[model samples]
Target: MTAVLPATLAAVDLDRTLIYSAAAAGDTAGLEVVEFLDGAPLSHATPASWELLAELAGRALLVPVTTRTVAQYERVRLPVVPRYALCGNGGVLLADGVRDPGWDDWAAGVAGRAAPLPELLGLLGAVAGQPWVRTVRAAEDLFCYLVAHARDAIPAGWLADTAAAASAAGATLSVQGRKVYLVPAGLSKAAGLLRLRRLLAGEGPAPRLLCAGDSLLDAPMLLAADAAVRPAHGELHEQGWTGARVAVTAATGAAAGEEIVRWLIARA
Candidate 1:
């Protein structure tokens, strides 16, 4: 059983939201490395964001909701270890650093509504053998994505056609940086947030939800919140997405991460 929480429930994405890579970061000065891969710095956060995030962790239930798989999510080392995290686009949830079995079951039950994983993988054949595609693989058998070089070089109608096809297959497609993702319609960050809300409500009063993200997948989770914020760059911003209560950050890259953390701390 968990105790009541007086602070807000903050659900934030990882890459390009709270952290940024060298290419995505624009500038690294005054930023701290939060993740490293093969001994190389991979993701970074502004020093101000780091200090503010630590403070936010103390004042709120700061949950890192991300599209990364559990293993990949583990690679990140934030200043504050959040009590809860949703990885695999919410197909996997962790509580107090341990995977939550109940949440896994819930996600599995919902997955049945979507096409079989094999069918989803078949969709990959479209991009397979393409010169621009760099890597393609499944994540925890929950979703599939492909990283491409020169994303803008792909045929204009290709993504739209593929997205439409994915929708018919009971999934949604999103483009984030060099990655093209196809996620099951039934498995969503919003659904996971709902489960979190239910679990927290069982412990005490319902907490206000505040979310932040910079990509298309993050849009659902952001929209599900009582209030949300997004960086000026990324898919949603490019799409000109807007909501009655949602806010957009003034900066982009690593600097925007600091602005977003400050936004959460002030509201939380």
Candidate 2:
């Protein structure tokens, strides 16, 4: 286990954690859900959940740590501004909606060591030698993910080995839904979150860290928190949640978010 910190904070994954995008399916961005209806299914945070988040906002800092680029993040829109945000899998840091200068230097320093997209694409093509591998696309400045039509096409063991190979080459591979992400080894929600925690350590005994996420990619952040929550669905659910507490919510993504808010309120 990582050492407990001196100050506490909440590091939450945005999609399916606090907000459910229109595209809930892994193969397709939730865009269709929004397009079919007039807009996406973003119900306002339940009153109790909103109150709890507000309480956390005042008592301890709330950071929206997500795998979204600043531009994409700007589009979904949040109910309230967070004190700090880690965007694009820690590629960018924002303080009160404005990009932080220090983080720019940090991103540049880290990006220098990561593999470029062209190299990553080549590796993906070389290793993923099968017709089952249907589509591959890049996420907003984070990295590329491959969608497979046949789950049995690549054995889980092969996926593990492939991920290890990618990591050795300075990238990470995380399978979510029908896709596998090739993220830079340096890009993680935990890295950016630890940086924010360090900045606030002097304020009080390191605040307890609380986090929530849906996939294996989120495992690092979830494990790093002082306490955490996991929804009914997601890779973490199948493996079981190791956080201090787990919230079993409705099967749907939007309903799970409501459960998260309720969990905070009950504890608060």
Candidate 3:
């Protein structure tokens, strides 16, 4: 009898990591549109990367962990349907295309331990009239974020000041690209992944974890993984973030997406 290998859990971030917008696609040509808005092309991945992702999905439990809203996440057309997905920065979990009620209850408990979303939203409103602030919205009813017209135009010390205030209120702050996120300190991708891991372990031995991402929000998830990979671009790279087991791709944009998929497949 042959010894069975433990399962592999590959959790990957979507935007800027596995997929890119036209503005971020770099030199990659023949892009496949992965996301559309009102029938207009919005996000894309290289044809090669798409094919590689299909192969990876067949090999491991492919979990797309993203900060995108549930509706926004459904817009992306991946070659394979993932068994599980964590969206809204772990605020929502989808199991077999259905929202898991148990996870929802767990998330509600986590939210209860933090400052209420309405209060955080009120704090955000105070700066919504700033010239550089483009739009402000609540994400999945769990946190809030503001879009800036230009990343550099954001007021000096605003991020630090807001982060400090949020911390005092039991929230956390992160600036990824042109978006500033104010999420609850008790809610994180790592926490969600750990819950999923426990649920998955009930079927058998725990799987070996591999994670990939390109933003500050991804750091906790990456750090929680047994092995992690990050694209050479995006917010994390911009801040020179790294970990003991984190591997980086040599390329940027769609090419980096391809490299990450290949790395996952090889490691799996």
For every model in order, what is the number of clashing pairs? 0, 10, 0
Candidate 2 lDDT, tens digit per residue, 155-242?
A: 6876877777788779887765566778887878888787777766655456677787887767788778766777787667777655
Candidate 3 least-lDDT 10 residues? 1-10
Per-residue lDDT of model 1, residues 1-268, tens digit only: 3475655889999998998988889998777999999999999998888989899888888889899999999999888788789998889989888998887888877876888877877787667788987878899778898888866856668888888888999999999888888899989888888788777778577788999998888878887899999999888999999888889999999999999999998888
Q: Give per-residue lDDT, candidate 1, residue 5.
A: 62
Better structure of 1 and 3 per TM-score: 1
Q: What is the C-alpha lDDT of each candidate?
A: 0.86, 0.66, 0.87
Off by over 4 Å in 2: 1-8, 21-59, 125-142, 147-161, 202-204, 241-252
Residue-wise C-alpha lDDT for candidate 3, range 7-79, written one tens digit per residue: 8889999989998987788854688888899989988888888998989988888899998989999999999
lDDT of 2 at 58: 59
Rank list by TM-score: 1, 3, 2
Winner by lDDT between candidate 3 and candidate 1? 3
TM-score of every model versus the real structure: 0.96, 0.73, 0.94
What is candidate 1's TM-score against the reference?
0.96
Better of 1 and 2 by TM-score: 1
User: Would you give me the overall lDDT of model 3?
Assistant: 0.87
- Angstrom error at residue 239, model 1: 0.1
